[model samples]
Target: MSTSSIKFYDRFSKLYPIVDVFLRPQKRRLFEEINLLDHGKLLEIGVGNGTHLGLYKKHALIGIDTSKSMLSKAIDYATQEMQLLHMSGEQLEFEDHCFDYIVLSHVIAVVEHPEKMLEECCRVLKKDGSLILLNHFTPNNFLGYIDRAFQLFSPIFHFKSAFYLKDLKALKKIELKEQIHFSRLRYFKLLIYKKP
Candidate 1:
């Protein structure tokens, strides 16, 4: 990760709660269908402020982020089973197939090389494990065109406004199991992939 991107998240850490409110309903809906009770250790990449940490009560949560400022705030939400680490997802320090599930909520588009991070996610995920992704993927319509136009400001926001799933090479290594378009305008997409 770049220093500028880390700095941007450091500044946004305080306001992230308010920003996360808009996506709460979407996240709730997505998590409802998934069964985490039987799962083992859960790793949430880019677990900002740990706002959604409570949802994974059944499993041990290992939340990782690149910003110290964000991790510091997330510490307040930490539980006995939760460990918040200030680390990058692109280079995860874990053995192969260590986790039964992984959550990459709203992370793909932000990282400088999303594909590399995804490869790491797959590397550490056990076979048959689910990789849940929630983000604003580009819609194939007028909204997508507008989204692409807004890419100019991504450097400032530290997120990709025009991110597409096809651009991620690691996707080919896994099978997409489910897709939930919860947003009214279909702006956000929740994808669940199973590593076979």
Candidate 2:
């Protein structure tokens, strides 16, 4: 993450707990999907505040984020079994096939290079291991156009990390055994990919 992005989240850390309260409904649904995974080591990219860490009861978890402030907040919740690393999604500091499961929750749209991030995810995942993603993407309807227009103004709001809808297409380069879509709102997508 850039210094500006780090600073932005650092300032917002005070408000994040409050923001997370309102986000529970969507987060719950995402957590429900993740619960389907069997127990194993899991890597969560962009693990902000570690709010979702409690959801993984059976899995040993490792989380990475680019913001030191966010990692500081996450450490408060970290158990002796969990490890948190300060790192960027685009460059993962791990060996190949190191994790049985990889998670990207709302991280792709915020990264400078989504494809590179996905490549790293694939590289770190074991053969036939799953990659789960819960993210907001462009709707297939008119709402997508509205999102596109709003994205143009994101910079003014200091949301420089937001990406437009088409970026999801970059997933095509990765080999996936299955792809699943959930959620009533077309704007939100849940993807399940398997390394081949």
Per-prediction TM-score: 0.95, 0.87
Candidate 2 C-alpha lDDT tens digits along 89-180: 78899999989999888777766667888888888889878888877777677766777778777654345333544555556655555444
Worst lDDT window (10 residues) for model 1? Answer: 30-39
Root-mean-square deviation per candidate: 1.3, 2.4
Which candidate tops TM-score?
1
Total backbone clashes of candidate 1, pairs 3 or more residues apart or in separate chains: 0
Off by over 4 Å in 2: 156-166, 175-183
How many collisions per candidate?
0, 0
What local lDDT score does residue 99 receive in model 2, on the 0 to 100 scale?
93
